[model samples]
Target: MTGSFGATSTTDEVLAGVDLSGKRILVTGVSAGLGVETARVLAAHGAQVVGAARDLAKAKGATEEVRAQAKNGGGLELVELDLASLKSVRACADALVAAGKPFDIVIANAGVMATPFGKTADGFETQFGTNHLGHFVLVNRIASLMKPGSRLVNLSSSGHRFSDVDLEDPNFDHTPYAEFIAYGRSKTANVLFAVEFDRRHKARGVRATAVHPGGIQTELGRYMTPEVLQGLVDSINANQPAGAQFSWKTIPQGAATSVWAGVVAEADLVGAHFCEDCHVAEIVEGVDIRAGVRSYALDPERAKALWAKSEAMVGERF
Candidate 1:
């Protein structure tokens, strides 16, 4: 179950010839960038895509854009979801479940990156709350509605290289908070989440995977200073001495791996694998970040522990 696709691949390219006529797909953070492109391509392939976002206006606008690009019109729908609030997640999940629609694919593609220290309405750290816990609860709440062969894709990032999950202080309760560290911890949780989720749910015919969409200039980087952004460019250049200094995929390219995981038949076979550039990435070592999954990111014990803790924190069980 190799998951590799090329860097130049787009959503349409990955979805080519795949007909999703009766499938229903839910993509969070679909208001912009890779999320929008993912929804557009899925809808084009005949999946009834619900573009979930915090803002109804933005969701509607993004849905329209996706609708315009859809070969089969009316395949896109707008749904409200605010990951920053667990209450909102509950409400949205309830609404969807009440509608009696079972989602065949769920791509947890929405997240905040490197934002200033803050907390969700539930008093959890913003990044961990919105990026990890919110999706955790949402998936658990909706797990009952998922029929056999359904898939859930958690959007992780190479930033998992930055840090592992901090069990002692996930909410930064006892330590000084750093934005990048918080973001990294959250992303690492994203990977472990999929790993443990697959462990628990795959036996029931559901599968979960995590993906690192290669760095693209998107709203996800809205909080970074120009110096920080340029510093990343400089670092990439310096690290890849044998290659181009900076390599970035377009939003469509960045979204390809996720879209592929959502619809590709081979995806189920590669459950719990961390993917990047549309493939099961090789594990890397020695702090050189260009290659593989970090040791900390794939710890099965850690994944299970985190899952238990998350269930405790959210007060729910799947």
Candidate 2:
């Protein structure tokens, strides 16, 4: 399974000949890019997909193609969700829980990156609140909906290499604010969430994993200027082996790994691990080439610490 796919593999290619009939998937952030593509491919493969977005109108418009292309009894539905707001997260999770429909997979795919320092509606740092804590509450609230054998895929990023979670000053009140540092902390939280979640649920046959979708020119980078992006690429390239250069992946290729780990790959291969390029990632340290998961991101102790801090921040325990 690992050799069959790589950085260039597209979602359609990874899922070719795979039938997802009777499966129900929940994907957040369907208004654009990877979320839309991931929902489309899953629906096209005969899975019923419930897509969540901050703007339902935008999501409905963006997902028209997903509905049209659905086959073999597959379909798509939309729900309103604003990950930055815990009220909305709880409401969305409550609605799903009330409906009593079990989900085969839950994809925590919505996130923000490198934004000017700000706070979420709940008064926490924006990146940490929205990217990590938002999904943290949402996923944990509805976790019971995922039966044994189900999977949870958190959309983390290579940006995690920048830093690990700062449990003591997660809101940046005592620390100086830096955009990518906050983004890195949030992404690392994403991985730790998956690691701890997998540990908590795996005995029941439910597993969770995080993925880096590769560098893509998506709305996720809307906050970063062209100069900044080029500088980043240059930095990554500078750290690569001789003659190797950094390149962006298309949205399809970017999303391939999420769907691959969610369904196509064996549960044992991906459970509780960080994944990239459609396979489980190696825990490499002291490198800056934009490949491999950072060892700190997968630390069980760090994961547990984050979980406890998240509960305190969100005022709810899973």
Candidate 3:
């Protein structure tokens, strides 16, 4: 089934009658925005939700909000996770494993966008390190703790259209570090990660998907300079003609697709697809279009190579 919702669809609307009692969901970056909304809706639906954030205080606040929204209340728990560090990722997974309960869905929603050029604690580029490699290790570390039929959702972006993975200089070693290109590479890796992940784990009943949550105005862009933000505003306005005041998605609306992918029963519809607006996206090409996964993002060989490189970097293998 090709289930389709729109950019305007809210989380509650998409999950209207779905019952998730007894299900367990792990959501990363649940401190605010779409991630918080996602945790709220899932917990409200009776899922045992774990809200993972880098800051314990933020996680506590977000969990309280989710609990207040939950019908049964206290269905949410908080965990500390800093995806920029592989050691932290492993530690978080260890804590979850210590809990001895398998996660039914793992949502890799936390990410850094176009931040200033920098290195992660492990010396990898910031965007690539946190957005892709960090999640890469986290998922693999926790893979054994995932029950059969569990789902993994990686939040990619339309920004992926700007560039593909730069295998030669993923860390910007020899090339100048352009923020947008770095972000694009990371987002592209998000898609490719899901592709390779599904290939490896689908037969074992663990499925993976990548999502482009459209252009929601969120804290993800907090690192952008005023000029950069204004340029983005101008570009959106010029292309959309709909008053370009970040007229893309509300947080709840943006979280709808991720929620759907987590709960939707149709396995065929969920895995290895680049989703947008709650449906499988149509393939796109060239510079002018605004739909579908770019071919490079889904290249299987590239995905495998990325997976191998990631395992080496993280010092772990799935």
| Model 3: residues with Cα > 4 Å off, grouped in runs | 1-4, 72-74, 236-246
lDDT of 1: 0.85
- Quote the lDDT for 295 in model 2: 92
TM-scores for candidates 1 onward, in order: 0.95, 0.98, 0.94
Tens digits of per-residue lDDT, candidate 3, 174-221, equal 999999899999999999999998998999999999998877778998
Better of 1 and 3 by TM-score: 1
Candidate 2 lDDT tens digits, 1-318: 544899999999999989999999999999999999999999999999999999999999999999998999899999999999999999999999999999999999999999999999999899999999999999999999999999999999999999889988998999999999999999999999999999999999999999999999999999999999999998999899876677899999999999999998888889889999998899888548588999999999989999999999999988
Q: Write the per-residue lDDT of candidate 1 for residues 1-318, one digit (tens) a residue.
A: 333467778877787778888889889998888889888888888788888899888778756768876665438888889999999999999988899889899999999999999999999999999999999998888888788899999999988887899987999999999998899899999999999988888888899889988889999999999999988777766777575455779988999989777777375655888887777777776444555688777889999899989988888876
Q: On a 0 to 100 scale, what is the lDDT of residue 220 in model 1?
A: 95
Of candidate 3, the 10-residue stretch with the lowest lDDT total is: 236-245
Error of 1 at 295 (Å): 2.3
**Ranking according to TM-score, highest score first:** 2, 1, 3
- Decide which is better by TM-score, 2 or 3: 2
Q: What are the clashing pairs of model 2?
A: none
lDDT of 1 at 175: 95
